[model samples]
Structure formats: structure tokens, C-alpha cells
Target chain A: MNLRTLLEEKKSSIVKKWVHVIFEQYPPDSTNFFLTQKDRFLNPVGHAISEGARDIFNALVDDSEPEKFYPLLNDIIKIKAVQDFSPSVAISFLFLLKKVIRVEAGAEIARRNLTPELEALESRIDQLILLSFDIYSKFRERIFEIKNDEFRRMTFRLLQRANLICEIEGEKTTPGEETVITNK
Target chain B: MAVQKPEELSKVVYTFPSTPWMDTPVEIKKGIFCWGNKEKSLKAVGFPNPRQWSVTDEDWKLPDNWKEIFIEGLRERVDKYRSFRLFLDICVRCGACADKCHFYIGGGDPKNMPVLRAELLRSIYRKYCTTSGKIMGKVAGARELTTSVIKELWYYAYQCTECRRCSLFCPYGIDTAEITILIRELVNLLGLNIEWIAGPVANCWKTGNHMGLLPHTIIDIVSEFKEAIYQVTGLKVDLSYNRKGAEILFVHPSGEYFDPNGNVTFMGYMMLFHEIGLDVTLSTYSSEGGNFGFFTSNEMAKRLHSKIYAEAKRLKVKWILGGECGHMWRVWHQYHNTWFGPVDYLEEPVSPITGTKFENAKSNKIVHITEFTADLIRHGKLNLDPKRNDKYVVTFHDSCNTSRAMGLFEEPRYIIKNVCNNFYEMPPQTIRENTFCCGSGSGLNASENMELRLRGALPRGNAVRHVRDKFGVNTLANICQIDRATLQTLVDYWAKGVAVRGVHELVGNALVMKGEKERTTDLRGDPLPGKEGE
Candidate 1:
């Protein structure tokens, strides 16, 4: 009748369901690829999503320390952040964990009169969702930063190499920084 | 009673997903990546990106004579590199390599596909070289070389890791990596380059290494490792330097001098040499074994790699022993003689400890470290106890260059098996000749285009995650500096708890040093397996 033990016991199956949900988020054409190709080399994005989802779930299940767990959560979110998903859609998987736990273990929770205990778990999921928002936003912001910086290499490279008159701000590149500015 | 609705229970596919660009013309935008090479480097190597031009802009600021330059460069390459000419003419466009590229698979940009990436250059080749293209332009799979096409080539060329996996599946055995190199060469005529590559090629030309570390700093790095050796083994291992008339002149990838895990591999080399009592000297002049210039162009790669034979002749060593590296092996095994050959000065490489003739490297006079070590193990020259590295659940990542270019698949694995008790291979498709790049090869490992790099690395990381889940693999061992630097990020990002190391670094941990202390920690100062509580 112990709902906590029941939740802990079904962790792997709950993780599988969470992974399946994330795989479905891939394109309709790629859905078969993500599902059928178990080889990591053949279907890497699928493997990453599934593996990353499992890591976050296990970390949540074991109640690992935040110091030990945030990095794991970041690893997964960073990939999704840079992908085509909008920020909300990128981190929606963190919310999927809540749905997975409820769907997988809802019967066990109600049968044992574990609403208050399960609510505690649900709130923890909410806390993780908030944390994931911070991680995904930071990651998305970084992609934009890289985009601006990568294309800007032409100015510094061309001006200096061509012997065009130019100016530099400083030694190390700061955010919103340029190494060169051409006269014309 | 609380059964979920069927609609809610089923998988919810999101709208606005990043779809692959299937036959869609590329849009030149700042949001998409085109990593720029540095100016000093472009100037150092004598290339074109000299006048600042942005990839995001509608104009690349090409000179009035750009058409003349393209024709000249194309003609020069076709005349010189038969492979280039053949690759341009022979593609049937069967699309065997369409889904083969790691970048294409991960990024979803169809242009990142090997077939299309090559076609970017091949279409121009068709227009200029073929008689049919002159008759039926744009219809015979030929497109005019517009600024948009040039910009598209710039974006996708650097995206390719030059892994050459696509070459294996082609019916004609067409190598896209060759097309990538030639296009990289063609772009250089316009002075366009990514800094990660041009910076290293420039530095290697001037400072004898990629990081621009001066000669004195290199000795200081070796001195620091000596201190670690003294701390671990008690007896100070005899560290030789630039010794002329030595029996062996050992060269390693310059990244080993300072990269965190690379230092571990360097220390492993020192301990192994000391343990085997081999008389060898490290070269300060030819410090770098791998050629960054190789990625720049054939001439630049040849220029950089020429230093090794020159150093070996200067030192008058009996033979040359190379350290654990990927592209260095590629250059040594495949292109050494063709680039800078007639190395008739030095004698053939033979292991002093094992007395193996090194028949494989007899003509080249350069022996791979894995080959030497595996030979030593075959003769039972090592006093290894595999239990020393018992903490690790090891897996070998067959570096793309060594696997594809050299076919060196077994020697490194033989050494890894001897040193570590637990070692697992990634999925069959991911290892050996079919290995995915570390995602940042060919000078694309820039901090700015991490989106491209991460997408490129997704396949490699995905395979790492499989073993970490299935077999509890925690250490990814390979013989690559780029892999060492980039896979650290990859493992941390995709498969946490897994660490990356050189194959030889594991060997050093297992080496039973002579007159050594009761060691408590292995290299990198991690506790030895049995000495964990100490």
C-alpha cells in the first residue's frame, strides 16, 4: 500500500514512457527513424533525447542533490534549445515528466490514498520545469550570440588582412565586441 | 475512473519544428552559421578573406576579378589533383550519401548532406568543365555560380567534418572529403577561412605548434609533467629534450603539451618510454605531429608536415616514433611521401624493447605509438596489471581519420584491451570506418558555431549515450587531440558521467613503473583502483 515504493519501483517503465513521448515530438518522417533505429549512430537525436530523459528521471527519482542534477538537466535542454523548437516547446519535455509519472503511476497513487504525497511529487516537477526554463533560455540566448559573432568574422579578417585601416576595442572579445572596424 | 482521454494519451507533435531544407534554396542569414577564419591567420597563410565581408550581407564584397580567380583556382586544382577532377565528373547523383553525413542527419539541412555539399562545387564544375553544361545550363544539374551559391558553399563546406563516411557507400567510391578540401582551397583564393583552422596553420608555420605557445613555454609544460611523474613514481623519470643523435625522435600532436587530457597522454608516453628504458628525444622544432595546414590545403599541410622529417634528420635519430593522434596518422600512412617524401635519410623504425622490425612502417621510417606498444605487449614486454584501471568502463572511439584514411583499426584496441579490464565498442555502424567525427574536425571547432558543432556531434554523442546506458561505459578512449578537446563537451552535454581519454593514457595508468612508490593515484591524480581508500 506504500505509494512511494510503488513510484520508485516503476521508475524504468515511467522513464520509457517519457522517452516515447519525446521521440514523438520529432518530425512525422523522422518518427519512424527515432523509434526503429535503436543503434545510437543511426539515430543519434532520438538516442540523445531518450538517454537525456532517462538521466533527468533517475536524478529526480533518487532525489539527487541540485549540484549533481542541474548539469544533467542542462545537458538535455541545451540540445533542444538550439534545435527548431521555441523556448516553451524546447523545455516542454520537463513538463512531460509530470504527465509520464501521473499516467504511469496514477492508479497506484489513488488506490493507496496518496494524493498529498503525489502532490508533493507534482510540485517537485513544477520546480524542475521552472529550472528548465532558465536553462533553455540561457542556451537559446547563447545560440543568438554565436550567430551574431560567427558571421562577424568577415570584418576583422578582411580589414586586417587587406591592410585596410582599422581599430580594435581590446584583447579578449567581450560580448557585442568587434576586433576591427574598416575606414570605408 | 480517472482513465486519460485517447487524444491526450497519444503523442502530441508540436508545430513550428525546425524542418530539413529539402531542395529549398539556402537563405543567406545571420541566424544561420558561417564561421569566419581570423585575419592575421588569413594574412599569415596568404589567403583572401583580407577585405572584411559579412556572410549575412547580401554582398560578399567579391572583387571584380572573382570570376577569373574561380576559373583559375578550379583549373589549377583539376590539373593537379586527379581525385578532384574525377569526383567532379563521376557522380551519378544516386544520392547514396544523401543521408550519410553526420551534419545532414543532425542539422536537418539537406545541403549539409555529403551529396549536396559536393554538388555545390560539382554544379559549378559541370557548368565550367562539361560540354553538355554549356548547351543545357541549369537543366543538366548545373547551376550558375552566383554569390548566393558561393555563400551557400561557405556555410555548408565548414559544416562538413570531412569524415569521409559518404565515400564508402558511393557506387563509384567518390570521396566528398576531397571535394571539401578542394573547395576549401578555392575559397582561400578569395581569402575566406574560419579562424579555428587558419589560426592554427599560421601558428604552426611560425611557432612550430598550433596554440602559438613559444618554445620556452613548451619546455615549461614538460617540466610541470616531470613534477607529476616525481610525485607519482617517487623516482624522477629521465625526461629527455631535443637530444641530437638519439635512437628515436618522438613527435606528438602539439595539443598534448597543454590540453588537460592530452597532458595525461603526454605523461603516459613519458612513463612508458621510461619503463621500457627506450632512448628517445622529444622535438621542440617539430613539436606538432598532426598538420592543421592539412585542413587548409594540400600545400599548407605538406609545408607543416615537412618539419618532422627535417627534425628527425637534424636529430640524426635511428627512427621516428609518433604519438597517439588521428590526422597525423592519416598524413603519415596515406599522404606523407606524396606530400614530403623521399625520406631516405633515417633507418626503418624498430622497437628496441620488443625487437619488432615494424614492417608496416619500414618504408616510411615512422612507427605509430599504438603499433609499437601493441608489439611490446605481443612480446610480453609490459608488466601490466589490468586491474589498475578497474574503475573505468572503457570504450574505444575509432577516430575517423585513422579508421578511414589509414585502416588502423586493431592496434589501438589491442593496447586498450591489455590495459583496461572493461572495454565496450559503440554500435557497429558508429565505429571503425563508419565512425562519426567529434563534430569539430576540419577547423569547425569554433566556440561561435557551437550550434553547428553540437548538431554535428549529436550522432557521435548518441552512440556514447547508448553504451553509457547499456553497458555502463564511462570512459571514451581515442587517439585524437580534437576529440579530446571537443568530446569533453560532447560527453558532458549528451552523456554525463562518461569521461574522454587517449588510449595511451589508459596504458600509462596500468604501467607498473620500476622503483616506483606505492602509488595512490593514477595520472590526472585520480585514485588508483585498489588505492581508493588511501
Candidate 2:
């Protein structure tokens, strides 16, 4: 499931249009714009998913099995909880990946491709976003719920970090170490 | 870490000249100009002592009429608001803004905490205004507004620089400073504003400035700087004031009218504008660029902003340029557009020299002096001689309101590098959006609260000293006039030998104005010609 190769064969116009729409949807402010625009993958959704895939792929190629990648993905999802990322948004991100892969790699890879592998990844991200949103929504629900300043502060850092990660990679990366396979 | 005892905090006293208040005529009884029992009041408040945490007998007694007047003022301001929905609706209070505060990091005081500070206003709003708040009350954890709470509000509201750094971290993007301003406005309505601030506000109302300096005094100061400019650059650039038909009107903080360091920047701005062939005028009627009304209430803010607009209209200038003052720019950049509108006379500012349209300015009508200068430099229109500033190692302190609230980061740094050699930056954490306030911001530099001012300034002084010691830096340059003034006092008291100057002053010194020798200040310490290299 080489998502990059799949994205490459697709008509550039459809990819370009979708990329434009996603960017317009989440117009990057000063902090996140550079991560998506300046990178080799100009499309934010593609850039994010590819980065995630590249990290996992590199880890797998390094002789680390799927077991290491799954937990790593889970940890990233936990971070997404802090970012107040929506599960729907994460699910939408996966759909974007499927769309890009279908456009670039054609129908065969789209049917048998990265979808199954990314399902758990999307679920993990969705759960994390939901958990973070719950915490954030509850915290903001009441003023007195603010027991100590530290609770509010820690949650904020989590959200800020989550937002940065989601904006950059299009998916959260694992918290712990993962294998890295260098092509060189 | 063990918490220090309240007694352990060092005590410092501030004494004001008695003559100014003593001579106040009997006729002016109600507002700031009226004289009161000075020594008794001073002792009652414990002028130099570390303020007691608890509100005590020392709180100055206001005339019975004062509260009525204050509440009337607040009612007037609240009535002016079309909606409080934005105020009530925004602000999730995740506390991402906690670490962003300089005062919070510097003092480690929980009260200085931005979230907690905002909660003070939020709690009050919930108790009185909100339907959910009224029904739930203590169950919802909403607290009643008492005199003690009002006093606490006064104390905390003054602490904020109104920098808007917290807004950057906010997910919904709430500005806590706006809440602080509203709290202060409400407090002022209750006739409970700190006497020190009220005096300045009144002075600003009476004399077109807070410092109470006369128009002639402003002219005298400008003339003296003109002489200095003449001796240094040989340019007979006329520093005109209250002149009609000038293409642009320049407004600056009243501190510039008195302080030498402040005046230097003022002269620098004039020299640069002259060299660029700008048709600009200075108005004594609205000479003070700062709106203390911003500290007080929205009505005052509107009133203060209106004065500038009226002056510009009276002068019939196409555009108005603001001087280097932090909160002034915040008000200008954030609210000026909405507050003063239908400014149909002025075209949206496209730098005549740069061709860069200032579309992002709150009102495309008025321009901040720093942005104007930076744009001119960016366009290659201004020829600067950087050799003039070789005497000192310089770094810029991005004014919090300018950098964080407005996203004006690169332009000033670009101006700094072009104007001086050896332009270095403070540690990355302290520059740009993360810059610290110079303790005296947000009207905390009031003469009455010198101890509080010193306590607040300690962090900035420490940062400046760290840079000076590590980098052998001799001068700290910034674009905000208040930062320069506040830091001048801070550096003098804490980090001696390090001088604070404006970015424009450095540029003005570096620019080869028409009468180069007569009108410009020297880049080096002495204006002597042969002292260039040595």
C-alpha cells in the first residue's frame, strides 16, 4: 500500500482541487501554514498522511513488526485527545487519504490498498480527538470545575501539541520509539 | 520550594511632590485637580510598603458623590455596547495562555495568572448577567461582587499589560485583556479607580495628555531635540506643531514630551519622515498617543480615540501615524477601525514610497510609525548609514501587543538589521510573540505604586541583564515608546549601564537627512565628527 505512488498516478487536477478545498477548510495560521505549504507534499491531507505512513513504513522496514507500529499510533491518538481534534475530522482525514490514493494510484490499489491498515489508525485518532474534546468541553462547561490552575494548563498544552501534530502530519505519530529504515 | 513569608518581601516607598496637589484651586473639588489631605492619605495607603494582601482601613475614602458618579459612568458605557455576546460567549479558559505571561513567570504570583485574573471578571459577569449564573449562583460557583472584590479587581486589572499573548494560545481565540478592560471600566463606574491613574486620566482630558505638560512645553522639548538634530546632522528640519495642511499627523505618548530618551525617538521619527520627504505635523491638542481610557472603560477609549481622529480631521491630513507605544497600537490595531469609522477622507494607506498596501491595518486609514518605517526600508526607498550605530551592540524587544496581538514580528527586526550593525536577538523564547512586558506597561508605571512597578519590572530587568552579560550588549532597542520609557527606569534601577532606545532613533541617527550634520544625532556617544570609528 504505497499511498505516495497511488497519489502520483491520479489526475493532478482532482488532487489539486481537493488539496485546495482542504486548505481552504483549515486555512493555516502563522504556526501551521509552513508545515503543509513548504513541504514536498503541498496538499495538507496528503502531506499529513504520507508523513504518518512514511514514519510507520520506515519503522516496519527497519524490521520492527506491526505490533510496534500499532501502539505507537495509539500513543499519537492519545495526544490528539489533548488537541481537541474531532473524531469526525480524523475520519474525514482518512477519507481524504482514500480519495488521494484513488486519484493517484488508480482503482486496484484503492480497493486492496492502505484502507485496512489505516482503519485502526483512523479509529485511534478518532478516539484520541474525542477524549481530548470531552476533557476540553467538560473543563469549559463550568468555571468552578477549574479546581486548580494546573489542570487547565496541562490540558491546554495537550491541545496545543495535538493541534500542531494534526496540522503537520495529518495524523498523530506514536508516543514511544518506532523503528526507522533509511533508504540510504 | 518553600513559600516566602509576606514579611520577607522587600518594602520600598514612593513619595510624590506635594506642591502640585497643594496648589489645586478649591473650585475643582470632585475630580483629580482637587486637593486632598496628602500626608494623611499617603500614610493611610502605606505608599512604599508592600501592599497588604487583605483590604484594610487604608483604602482611601472617596466622597459620597464619587460612587454615584462612577456608577453613572459605568452605566453609560454599558448602554453604549450593542452586544455583550462576544464577551460572554468566547473564552474557554484552557490556560494555554499561562506560560505566555511575563508577569506570571516573573512573579510566580498565582493572582498574576491570566486565567485566574480573567476569572475575576467572568465570575462577576456570571453572577449578575447570565441566566445560568443567576439560577445556579454558588452551585455554579459564581461569586457575589462586593467592595472587596472590586478592590481585588482594581489590583489585578492594573497588573495585565493587556498584551493579548494569551489570545494566541486560545482555541476559540479569546482576548483576556478585553475582559480586564471591561472590569476596570465597571470598577471606574463605581468611582473606585486608583487615584494615581484617575489623576493622569483627568490630566489627559484637560491638557490633551496624561503628563499635564502644556503645549508650549511640548514645543520647547521638540525645539531642544531640533537643536540636537541640528548639531548632529546639520539638517534644519522644522519640527512643526499644530500646523494645518500637513499631509500626515503624528501622535505619541505624553512621556515623549518629557524624557530625553523618549524625545530622542520623537526626533528620530521626525528626521526619518523629513528625509523621506513626508509632509507631517504634530498636534498639541491630541499630542499624547496613549489612551488611558483603554485602561478605564470603552467610553473613555472611544473618547480618547475620537480626539486623535478629530485632530487629524482638523489638520486635514490624509493619514495619521502613531508613535511607539504598546497599548496604543493594540487599541489602534484592534479596535480603532470599528470605533472610529466612516473615515472617508483618508485613502487606505499604500505607502507612497513602498507601493505595499497596508491592508491588514485595523483601519487601512492610520499607520503605526514602526510599520511605516519598516515598509519604507523594505521598499529600498530609505538609504541608511549603519556605520553610525557601531558604538553599541543592539537587540530588539518586540512590544507584546504589537508582536502577539497584531503579528508584527519581522518588520521591526528587518528595520533593526538595516539600521544597525551587530543587531542581535534576545534568547528565542523572549523575542517576538513570546516577548516579556517592561513592568510598567498597562498603567502599572503609576508614580504611586513604585514598589509594585519595581517588583513587576524585575523580570524584564533580569532578561536585559542576562543579554548584556552574555552578549556584551550595551543597548536595548524597541519600537514601543512605553517599553523604552519603562525600561529606562528599570535599567537605571536594576541593570545599570544598559540604555534603552527606540528602533527609529537608531534609524534616524543612521539616516543621512538633508542637513546631515545639523539635524541628526550621532550614532556614537558623542556627536563629534572624528569620533565615528573610535
Candidate 3:
């Protein structure tokens, strides 16, 4: 069989392996918990990872364009963005798919003289990795934006109180010039 | 290590940690922890060891005898509160609550597990306060109380929002939120407090509210609300400050008068009160209904919350009417009588308009706004136009304190159903007593800890995402002030178009007042549902 037929035949096992390896990045205890828990609300992170993985795999095999993967990639990347993972380590889970595809269907491709087709699939995975990089940056930027917005809202009352109450009589300090205690 | 067989390529190795949990060192990650209490804030509250320190520092600059103080404080608490000591001793660790924490479910941090978070303190309790622990040591799951242990305790203690979700599923009825409370009490002895809780505690103690608004500042903010109210309803709403002998004293979280979302809720209260002609007066001194001190220690909670009863006595109101806040009602319903009780100075809260006695609050003499509003709606007192709220396909998020502690399940919903045509409940497991936190309750709602907040917000946000995807829910309603602030940020991130609103904001939009001008917009100045073109 050619690469497409091989991939379609091996789709379930490949996605399963991809999700399992992705969960392995968590702590051993967490990995076990993720594997065992099936409730969506009870184990949201696990659900997100598993569901996002299958949808992303199907999207890839269907030869969908990169933009079609935004929601799927965003679901998993959003979780990893807030998690205690470095940026490279956070998005690195995408790279593991190539290794899984090679391992799951590599021998079949070789025997069928579909090495060029396998390379094309691997390049698609690379494109997904690049797309995840853009998603990671968007989420990280969204987090910072959230922090800024929360600060503005929290201080909304205080700022309004300051503006409507009175002018500074003595030191005349600006609103942003409070003695902020910073710790290195 | 080449794979000889193709099946070996998918071989997954599951290696358990060699070190026991007791021996595993704690690493305090950045973006997950809060900033330490500033010296000025600690000094304002007369707390011990008022020195500037950072969680990232090598030396936390604790009092030289911080260990002695922590041990002494823990022992004093164990002696003082029987329930606390029982909670410390009775946990069987069935792991029933292991998967119940929102943080654990969202972030996958094992330490965020309710059992493990409590064990951070329980292990120390075993080492210092128990005999078997002294003899068996790590075999009995005990560890020495070192600086690293203190750091870990601080890290995980703040990670818990004290929502008590885990306690709901505990077979042994182990209240992990109490454990987190006790841990925070001990850490305060060492000056290991986060700035978010400490700053508010100091402000509440000194300026009568968390935001440190002076009496005039509060009045000015209310005046601005008055202008907004006049512009919307075309009639002036009467407001009084500390007016003696008023029939009721209205105490709300100061955020209600200040924040944008809270301002809408505040306008809702004004419209309701004006419609009924209720004799209610606001107090600038007891402006804050939320007790941040409750998150710190019992003593500080008492100190800050004393202002409510004190203001009531000063004003000589018949009874007090509380506004839409989550933890404030928890403190009122659960701890008010114990902290400052016999409440003989005020009378029972009887609805002046509907003549319905709030028999549930007979002892405390403080009535929740929903309980009061629901009673009015039951009596068919206020003319409500639910169609005005058609712009919002709303859902109610049960604030943790109100749902678990106060059992206030139906009052807010009753009010919501009366005031809105469309409302939806989240998943069965994620509403009412089993509700998830906005992930920023108990004063963890600070800007610096955004990642921790977002991580903890996932379960609640995910449920919201489901409802929004399924039912076109555009508005999230609740009775909590912190929810008003944090869940807005949360929905902005998770459910992009979903807006966070207070339950009362919907009420204000739906209430049809007598002699009101031709209304064109809701309390938020958004165009009304049917009046959008005009």
C-alpha cells in the first residue's frame, strides 16, 4: 500500500501512540491519572490533550491546510502555555508525531517504495510544528494581555476613587508613581 | 540504543521517582507563586516579622525563631479549635478527593491535589505534634519542618483557593480548606504572606475597605453611579450614608461601587431598593462586605468584619441587608455569630415591601440580597420585564463559598429566572455545591499570579466553553464580587465572546420602574434587547 493508505490503516494506533507519548511529558503520577480518568469535566487537561491529538491527526491525514489546524492546535497549546513548561518543551509535543508516524508505518512505506511520500508527510508535520509555534506565541501574548487587563480592572475602583476624590496636596505624586515594593 | 524490532520503537518507559514524597525537594516555580507580603502592609496590620522578602530569595528573612513560632501557633490552634485538630488527625487519605481539585484537574500538578496540599501541612503536624510520627519518622509519612518545608507549605497553601470543593467529596469529611486556612495562619507568624491578601487586609483594617477608599472617595464613586443611574432610568435614586435609624443597612463589597461589572450590579441594587422604597443606608466605614482577613487568620477576620455589626449598632438600623458577594455571605452565614455574636443590637430581617420575614437569618439579622429579592419576586412586588435581558443567554456560576458553606443554591436561580427569559445550568457536576471556583477566590486573584489563576480556571472555563458552544451563552452571572473581576478575565480568555455579569445586573436590566423615562439601554449602557434601534 502507498503512504496514504498505510496512514489510513494505521490511524487509530498512530493517534493512540501520539497521545500516550504526549501525556508522558507530565509527571508519572499525572500520566497514570490521565490514562485512567475518563470524565471530561473531572480530567479536563487529559481530555483536552487526548481529544486535541485525535482531531489534529485526522486533520493532518485529510491533507487539510495549515489554517484548519488553529482550533485543534490552540486547544492543546493553551493548556501547555499555562503549564510549567518552557516554550520549546511546551510546543515540542508536536515533533513527537513524526517519530510516532515513522515508527508505526515506516516499515510499510519502505517496502512499498513510498519513502518520498513519507518525506512529504513528515514535512506536513514540520509545517504543523511551525503553526504550533505561532499558536504558542499567541497564547503567551494573550496571557500577558490578560495580566495587564486584570491589573487595569482591579485598579479601576482605586483609580476612579483617586480621580474623583481630590488632588494631591503635598507630594503631588502621579497615580502610577506609588512606592511599589519590588522584589528581585 | 537502536530498536532491533519495530515494536520496540513504541516502547514507553514509566519510571517512578526513586525518592519518597517526603524526601523530594520542593522547587518554587516562577509565575505560579505570589509575591511576598510587603513590609508596609505587614506593619500596618501589626503582624510579626514585618520584613520585605521574595519567594525567589535564598533567604526569606524570617524571624530567627520562626520554627518555634510556627510550632507554637499550630499547637495553640489545635488546642483552640477541636474541628481543626480533628481535620488534621482524621484524614484516611482514601484519594476520593485526589481528582476533585480544580487545580489538579486543570494543571495536572500532583501537589495541587487536595489530599497532597493538606499533607504539606499534615506531614509537619505529624513530625511535631504526634507520637507515632516522632517514632516512625518518614515511615509514618512525617518530615522535619525545615525552611524548604516552609516554602513548600507557602507555595501549596496559596495555590488552594479555599473553595472547599475537595471537602465536598471527602468520605471522612476532611475540610482541606480549613487546613489551608491553618497553614496560612502559621505562615503569617513567619511573615510569609502574599501581597494580595496582605495588602487588602491592611487596607480593610485601616481604610475600612480592601481598596483603601476614604469615606469621601467612596461617596464620590457613588455620586458617579448616581449620575449613571439618572442617565439610564431618568429618575434620581435616593442614597444615604450612615443615616441613623434607617430600617436597613446595605453592606456590599466596595468593588460593587467601583469596578465596571460591579457598577452595573450596584445600579441593579439601587433600582430594586428605589422601586420598593426600602429604607436602606450605605456605610462608608463598613463599605467592604468581603473579609480578606478570613483568608489570613481567624483573628484578622474578626478584626476586619467587626465593622459591619459596629456600623449597624451605630446607625441603629432594624436589620442589615447584604449585597451580592460570595465569600462575604459565607463569613456571615458560617462564622459571623461565632466571631461577633449574640447579634442582639439589630432586629430580624423582615422585608419591608413584601412583609416576608427572613427567618433563616433570624439569629444573624443579616439578609442576602438574593434571599430578599426572591422573596419580593415570590410576592409579585416588583414589575419585571424579562424580555429586556434577551440579549444575554445567561448561566449562573455558584460562587464556592455560597454554594458549599451557605447552601444558597436556589435563591440566586429563583431571582435569575424571574429576571431573565433565558438561563442555562452548567454540567451537573460543575454547578451548585459541586461548582468550580473562578480560580481566584480567597485573595489569590492578583495580577502577578496570572498563570496560576488561568491554570486553575480551566475546569470552570471549560464548563463555560461547553455551555457557550452548545447554547449560545453570551453572559455568565454570579453573586460574587471577585467572580465579577476574575471570571471576566477568565471568559475573555476561554470563551471569547461570553461576558461575566452579576445576577443583579440582569435584575436591574429587567426591572420596570414606575415614572421611569423611556428606557433605551441596560445598566451597562448597552442597547436594550427590543430598543436597540431606538
Top-TM-score candidate index: 3
List residue ranges in candidate 2 displaced over 4 A.
A1-184, B1-93, B131-136, B352-357, B361-364, B492-495, B518-534
- Sorted by DockQ (best first), the order is 3, 1, 2
Ranking by lDDT: 3, 1, 2
* Candidate 1 C-alpha lDDT tens digits along B138-230: 788777877667777777777788888899899999988889988888887877777778888999988888877677878877887889888
How high is the TM-score of chain A in each model? 0.81, 0.34, 0.86
When summed lDDT is taken over every stretch of 10 residues in candidate 1 chain B, the lowest stretch is: B14-23
lDDT of each: 0.77, 0.59, 0.86
The parts of candidate 3 lying over 4 Å away from their true place are A157-184, B1-19
**Tens-digit per-residue lDDT, B158-204, candidate 3:** 99999999999998898899999999999999988999999999999
The local lDDT score (0 to 100) that residue B484 gets in candidate 1 is 83
Q: Each prediction's TM-score against the native?
A: 0.79, 0.63, 0.93
Question: Is 2 or 3 the stronger prediction by DockQ?
Answer: 3
lDDT per residue as tens, model 2, A1-184: 4543433444354345444433332312212331333322112223443344445434432445545555444422322221212333422432453444445444555476666544544454445345444543442232122212223322332343234323234332221111222333
User: What DockQ does each candidate score versus the true complex, computed on alpha carbons?
Assistant: 0.14, 0.01, 0.31
